[model samples]
Target chain A: MKKKLNLRKATPWLSAIGLFVLWELVVRIFNIPPYVLPTPSESIIVGWQFHEAIWMHAYHTLYTTLAGFAIAVVFGVVLGALVGSSRAIYDAANPLLVGFNSVPKVALVPVLVMWFGIGTVPAIITAFLISFFPIVVNVATGLATLEPELRDVLRSLGATRRDILIKVGFPRAMPYFFASLKVAITLAFVGSVISETVASNVGVGYLMLSASSKFNMPLVFAGLLVIAVMGIAMYEIFNVIERRSTKWANRGNPTN
Target chain B: MSNSFVELNDVKLRYSEGDDLALETTNMKIDKGEFIAVVGPSGCGKSSLLKLVSGLMPPSEGSVIVDGKEVAGPLKIVGMAFQNPTLLPWRTTLDNVLLPMEIVKPHRHRLRKYRAEYEERARKLLATVGLEGHEDKYPWELSGGMQQRASLCRSLIHEPELLMLDEPFGALDAFTREELWDILQNLWMIKPFTVILVTHDLREAAYLADTIYVMSKRPGKILVERENTLVRPRDQETTFTQPFTDLVHELRSHIRDVRES
Candidate 1:
């Protein structure tokens, strides 16, 4: 079992290294130009050379993504609880939320830029808009699907509605809420990048756009790599929190 | 009737308008501290009787009186357990047992002030159910029998006057079920709360209940009420005796009649 766990831990890194080697070989064999398709090594070199600039842009992107995600968390929890509390609120708001969610957030970046005018605000709003829906949907589902038997137990105890909500509903919704955060954090990055590419003057998205315009393809690739790493890191953080806080939910499924 | 602790008078329950009645013209009178069990076929509304008596659901017609007062809504004086232990997955066994005191007042009002006292009561109840060392464990970590034992602790912790059990031991193995009967019997002997147990098991009904009620198929109504004459402090050895077997057989005949009809 220990050997298997060690192997599992090593597999992802080994596969990533092998992929980079293959990419390097393929580029070298094809004699691809740096401007068109830089080798993995070339991209790494360029990434290292531009580390200072990349770090600044990465920081801006991170802040905007986190700010938007934080807002999404607050709004999603409150709205999800309200909608989940009754069938009437769910019925009244569900269609509007679905319609709003269906509209691609990419299209809204321009309108946001027009209003907020090419800064962190548009990127933040874009991230908020894209990520909040999943949190709301998951949290609402968690609250809504509370077992009828459990509800009956509380109700028969002369527990008030507020008592049931606080004691059972909210705690039950937590696992779902954490699950949504993992999904939403990735989407939050997507939203921020989209706005950065279209409207913002700073961020990894803007850096990539600017680098690609100058035919610095290796730098652009490095920006993409940075964004991917950041996304994975945030996702891992939430995953750890989810596992720790809601271990009981996963007791039956120990393999997770 | 005036002396009855829980009185159901011509109770009729329809879940919704234009729907068939779940229970029709059901009348029952249970004395205080009586261990009453309702047994019937599936979907026979045996559970509906327990619900009405607990005031979890109001009767569509007529009234339910408990302790000389009409039941308007859910009563604080009742403790309930179902076939599924239904302990919250998040809470430890001790905390799950203490859940009633966290909600049902005057305990709810005093919970913060008397946390240690309540925790001690919870621990004692868990000890009674053979769950002393398992108090800190989560519900999922425990076996079904252990979880059900903890659930029983949860139900009785608040010390409610009325205990409502709906097939509480139906999901357990025979040995576990029999063991729980002894545990329940001891608890009842010690505290003497009024109990309304609904089950399909005739032997269980005969073993635990003072009065065994047989319900007809839906829309259900009481068909027979048999007073158990088997001696008190009943155990597995007593179950082998002729009188206990006779009581079970007699209840079985009533159920067979109801099923055939």
Candidate 2:
């Protein structure tokens, strides 16, 4: 049993390494020019060689995503609570929210650039906008879909509406809230990078764009690797946080 | 003007105006600390009756009074359980049980200061329901029977004057259901809180209640009100007795009549 557990734990790392090795074999076998498609080894070697630049860009991207995500969390929860709790607010805002979410966030980058002028502000704002929707939608869904039986349990206690929301609704929404955080954090990275590529000079997105313009495919791949790693690191952090805080929600899933 | 603990007078309930009535005009008089079971066919609005009595829903036409006051909203002196148990999944068995103390006033205010005192009370209730050590486990971690037991503890923890149950044992298997019946009976025998238990199970009604109310199908109103004189502290053997069989048979026939009609 312990051996099986160890194998299960090792699968992700094994799969990742296997993919890199396959990429190397495919590149060598196909004799693909690095300018068109670089081997994983070349990407990693190039990435390490420019570690200082890559580290700076990665750090900036990480902090920007975190900042936007922080804002999104606060507003998303508040707006979600409002929209979820009352029929009137939901009816009034739902169409607008739906319309807003439907418009691809990438389309908004130019408008953000126009308003905020090509820099950190535009990147941060874009990150906030792109990531905000899921957090709000999930939080609202969590509160809105509270089982009627559960509501009756609280309502039957003579609990006020506020009391019900605070005591029951929010706690019930924790799993959904965390689920949104994971998605939103990843999207926040996308948002930040989109803004960086279009409007800013700093961050991994900008570095990749710079490398690509110079036809430095290996360097571009290196920057891509940096962004992917950051996204995965953030995702893992939220995953751990979720597993610790909402174990009850994961019932019937194999123990993580 | 009667001094019944819970009285529903000419009560009618509709989800909306000009809609089909969920409950027709129904009247009931329950004495303080009396245990009553409501039994009927499916869709008989037995649950609607409990909701009215507990003030979770108001009757459309007539006044419903409890403890000398007309119920304008949900009553504080009521503890409720449903077929689903409805224990918060996020909460530990004990925390779920103490949910009322976090809401019902005086207790909510004093919860921080007297949390330990309240915990002891909650612990005793859990112990009474055979959930003493399982208190710290999350509700989802427990079996269906154990979760339901914790729900029962939660309902009674606040020592409400009226305990409203809507098929509280309906989801359990037969053996677990029977075990819970005995546990519930023992607890009631000790404290004797007024109970309004709604169930489709005639044997359960006969075993646990002083009075059994049978209701008709939708737009439900009481069809029969039978008083039980069964021996006290009813057990498994009592269920096999001739009188018990007779009572269940009688209730079954009434239910069959309603279902047929």
Q: How far is B251's C-alpha from truth in model 1 (Å)?
A: 2.0
Q: Best candidate, lDDT-wise?
A: 1
| Residues A163-245, model 1: lDDT tens digits | 99999999999999999999999999999999999987899999999999999999999999999999999999999999999
Q: After superposition, how far is residue B254 of candidate 2 from its true place, in Å?
A: 1.2
lDDT of 2 by residue, A1-256 (tens): 9999999999999999999999999999999999999999999999999999999999999988899889999989999999989989999989999999898888898998888798788888888988989988888898899788777878878889999899888988899999999999999999999989988999988999999999999999999888888889999999999989988888878867
Q: Which stretches of candidate 1 lie over 4 Å from their true place?
A: A30-36, A252-256
TM-score of 1: 0.96
TM-score (0 to 1) of chain B, per candidate?
0.98, 0.97
CA error at residue B258 for candidate 2, angstroms? 1.3
Query: Alpha-carbon error at A153 in model 2, in Å?
Result: 2.1
What class would a CAPRI assessor give candidate 2's docking?
medium
Most accurate candidate by TM-score: 1
Error of 1 at B181 (Å): 0.4
lDDT of 1 by residue, B8-106 (tens): 999999987888999979889999999999999999888878778877788999999999999998887778899999899999999999999999988
DockQ of each: 0.72, 0.72
By summed lDDT, the worst window of 10 consecutive residues in model 2 chain A runs over A149-158
